[model samples]
Target: MMMKAVLVDDEPLALGFLKRQLEKVSSIQVLETFTYFDSSSNISVIKETDIVFMDIEMPERNGFQLAEQLLELNPGLEIIFVTAFNQYAVQAFEVHALDYILKPVQTERLKKTVKRAEERINAKQEAISEKPTKLCINVSGELMFHLTNKDPEIVTWRTLRARELFLYLLHNRDRSINKDVLTELLWAEVDQEKAYAQLYTTIYHIRKTLSNYRDYLTLKSVQGGYKLILSNTIIDLYVWEKKLKNLSTLEGQTIPIAEELMAIYKGGYLQEYGYVWAEAERVRLEQQWVEAAQQLAAYYHDQGNFSSAERWYRELCNKHPDDEISNYQLFKLYALTGKNKLAEKQYQIFKKALEDIGTGVPHTMEKWYMNWKQGIARKTSM
Candidate 1:
């Protein structure tokens, strides 16, 4: 396969020479050359191009920064940094540049870089084609499929109906969903006959998308309905909830386990998708996480682990900024630890959060703060 490349060098001589050298390699096709990095002009070409040969020292920006931006646009785009200095070699690899070739690029060295780029591109393509043995469905944030020993693959649905239908089936997997219910839920705007036809077409697309994971996920028709069966597959939310249920009382031995559970919660269930059907589950799972986090923080506070307590409470406050109990706990913890400024900051945050929702700080909390302030004033006078 021919690999398309772009050359970016501030020096006209260097840019022309690199392009000429690349021309020597039959596999490398020079698509575009740039004297400077211009986002507007370069972005469109960079998207289609396979490789970029960039100089480390440029007028607008260093090659490392430019490469980072390019990678963000096309993550699969290979970057080969060409420069006169040997010092930038280490920095080149730091940004994951494919190869670092010195200036006055040799034909042999250039060929080696081209070969390496081709190998990497081919490997990525092969990985995409390979089927996964086991599957892990992540619904905590966005919908993602984490295949065993492979990067998470985001499913690209053929159409909106196909996406919603597949998510609905996955959400209620193992139970046969009647065609009538699905039709009413998704295709209510269409006529009955047209709706059914659309459903069938959507299901076909879903099946084709899941063809690689057929061994793990089986979507079958069951007597006027459809069912999605999971074998050797797990959903992150289910696994997290199960572990939370099985967890015993929090202690020195169980603290690590609690921390591990906290790490697993990437975000609310299907948070990014914003599916109305998933709202209840999302709120429920979030509450579960909040409760677990509160229990862990309280345990640390009770055991006189003030530092750990502060850390967990801060985490809770970050995730649920309006959580009054967590904010109060953090305020008290900071006060006890002699971080009066942080304690006051926490109180102000709590106050603003409550006020935003048309509420005030609880009377008892206000009274406690007033009393604490008076005591501080008395001590300061002495």
Candidate 2:
């Protein structure tokens, strides 16, 4: 495997030297070089590379901080610290650095590092290959299924009615859906005999498609109805709700689980399908996300960790921009954290957002802003 690599060093000479040395390794393909860590540049580079050779002393960001952010952007990214200081070797390894090399890197040492990188990359691939293939159904935004093996299976319907029928049964999985209800929902415009025939043909195609996936799925005909059953399958909605339930009952230091829960919510439930039956569940899951985000934000803010609180609040706004209460809370956090510019910017955006929705700003918000300004003035005066 040809590993795509990036070099990040503030010193031009050091960056050049590393680039030249890396070129000696036939397995490594240099994708990009950066003198400083700019979020925009680094993130773009990260999307195309597997390894980042980072320097310890950059102007604004040190190697450790850059490494953390890089991993957050691409968790599988391998980081190798190339620096002059041997003192940082312990710290670099602690952060899961693949290898640490000091200034004036030896060609042999560099060769060994390249070999280790190849080994680590191969091991990761082998581990992924050994894992069981998961069946993931996204009933949140798109009606789709993905095998953990990475190839997505697109269900082609013999007729549009066939697709809708399968979705109906999936929506009411485990419960037998009555034939009359199915007919009314999917075939109301057709004649009785013809409608029944259509349903039968649709069910046949569904069964045929599912036949090969018997280990993962099943469709059964019950007395006067049909039922869809899933085995070893993961539905995002079910997982999100389960995580929400678990996280809601717990208090304090729930960041780890909160992060997991946030990842599970792909988007509004079955949004692409736009079936009337999905709206209620969609609304319910959205509320769960809101509560989870709010709780995490409050937890971080209460802990005097403004940075983490800001991150969660920003995510909340992305999901629910109309949440004025959250916007106000975020504004307060920004002001308290001494981000006066961001606080003011948030207020303007919030005000305009409310006006666009025809609600205008509330009296409570006006009063709160006045009090906040007064407090700021008092601090400034003192």
Candidate 3:
């Protein structure tokens, strides 16, 4: 059967735009739309609806409230968030929403996401959901609960277990966790089948709680495992990764876009969370941070801000003493500021450091020494 959909929005144009887009999706059919709240009678139009494309801010009865009542009427209804963005990302992650779309939705993004939704619908039609009735994903430092039932209000982080489970998925947001692994970590060795059942129970309870914001978070099953799908616009950590990739191409003497990028680096991509792959990302970002610092130092040095330039270059050298460029920059910055002795000392240190690491100091350092000698000869003649 084709996936049936209902669009609930307070704006007429927004509803129209979605209806037209769904027309192209091939698999999704719009059952109805509500630009304004009417009667409970409206629910009848979508009695067989598979998914609700819901907007959070609506007239009279808000979408959240409306969704609650509608779910009360039919507990099996699925939801997808369509918000212009109201700090919804975290809540979305916690609630286990299927997917979310932002305002002015791009056609390509919408089409691709709808295709995935269709896949989910087909999979559900065939898969044995005997595993768990609900899915609860921790949104890092918070609990986002979802289940078949519908509740409108948001969830808060209260217990240690809530925090633990939520942070686990948030840290591993990109990767799926195996049920067997979760069972081992959560319940330890217990009876095999019993532990599996207990694991399902935890996920079910978490899901049941998260069902409140079902439109925002989506925990999907695939290949004998499950994965937490997150929105890039909602995740600043992802934004940083994008900026860092482009930053390497920036060579010299431009505005500090890299610095602006670095400024937005908020605590290392869900810093408090931990997972097996988290350290690899941490190391990656740390290296990027160091690289940005080096670039900013060079930019400032060229701008004649000797103090700021030296400050950054010194940090790069101190943190990564073996970096040849950082050492050379330090020496150059010192020389420019009329600290010849300091410059000579840094060059000496660079040579010794490189020798200790079994590599020759690059020819660039030798030029600094040649210039120093030339200047001394000129001074003696004067």
Candidate 4:
């Protein structure tokens, strides 16, 4: 398959040389070349192009910053940073560039880069074509959709209002919402007629955008408002929750299944989107995850699996820094294991966590710490 590429270099000579060399490669098709990014015209082409060959140094905007903007437009777009200096190699990969080639570019090296880009593009295409038709939506970390065999891609909404309206419907999918309720929630500032008109236009845009997934999703006009019906759809949050509910107890055999379920709850529900309406459900789901994690951690602790217990408890503490139970458990585990310094550090952290919330350690916890400290002192004296 022929892969499309775009080149960006401030120097006309270097840009021409790279373009000419790419033309020699049979698989690559140079689509456009830019001396520097013209925010207006270049963005559309960048979105359409498959790969970008860019220089590290430029006058208008450095290649790193421009590459970032381009990747934001098309996350799948492969970036190959070509520069004379080798020091930028580390930073180039940090931004997830495909390859770093130094100038003056060599024929053999350019061929290798082109071959790699072609393989990557072909792999992505094959992945999409290989799988059966299935719709997967992930709202755990962010709003992303995977249709058929394609990789998960974030929906680029036509407008902010369009995005918000779609998410609102999705949050309350399978049920018809009232038009008055939606208008009041989203377009309260506008006049009634204008709000309704804007709503109609936004709905039209959404339907046009989702026309490709007509088999799996349907945005229907109900008696009053609209309903988003999902068919043959696998939502990550739903699958995780359902599996979690089915697991009655965590046993030696069941531990792995429970661990898999924990992994499915990637992050708080719709956490990245920050939709105020999603907050309640997010909190509820988070609490469920915490309860399950607590159960798993307690089981490991009881089974004398200190390493696994510490791993899960630390994960819990990382997710919920002010979780008193996990913090105290870690403290006890470390103290009993004769790691007194780690125990002390954990105790201090627990104290500070509570203090941050305008509280202090509970009397029972304080008493336990004091007793442990006295015991340590006695042992030292002995």
Model 4: per-residue lDDT, tens digit, 44-123?
89878999999998996888998888876886899999999999999999999999999999999999988988898888
Q: Which candidate should be chosen as best, given TM-score against the real structure?
A: 4
Q: For each candidate, what is the lDDT?
A: 0.90, 0.84, 0.68, 0.88
The lDDT-based order of candidates, best leading, equals 1, 4, 2, 3
* TM-scores for every candidate against the unseen true structure: 0.62, 0.57, 0.44, 0.63
Identify the leading candidate in terms of lDDT: 1
> Candidate 2's residue-wise lDDT over 45-149, tens digit each?
797788999999778779999898888688688999999988999999999899999888888999999899999999988967886777888777767788887
Tens-place lDDT digits, model 1, residues 150-194 = 999998889977878888999999999999999998989999999
Model 4 poorest 10 in a row by lDDT = 35-44
Worst 10 residues of 2 by lDDT: 246-255
lDDT of 3 by residue, 187-242 (tens): 67698799877766666665665454455555656575566665311444455667
Candidate with the larger TM-score of 1 and 4: 4
Which 10 consecutive residues of model 3 have the lowest summed lDDT?
Answer: 135-144
Candidate 2 residue 152 Cα shift, in angstroms, is: 4.7
Error of 1 at 331 (Å): 1.2
Residue pairs in candidate 4 whose N, alpha carbon or C atoms collide under 3 angstroms: none
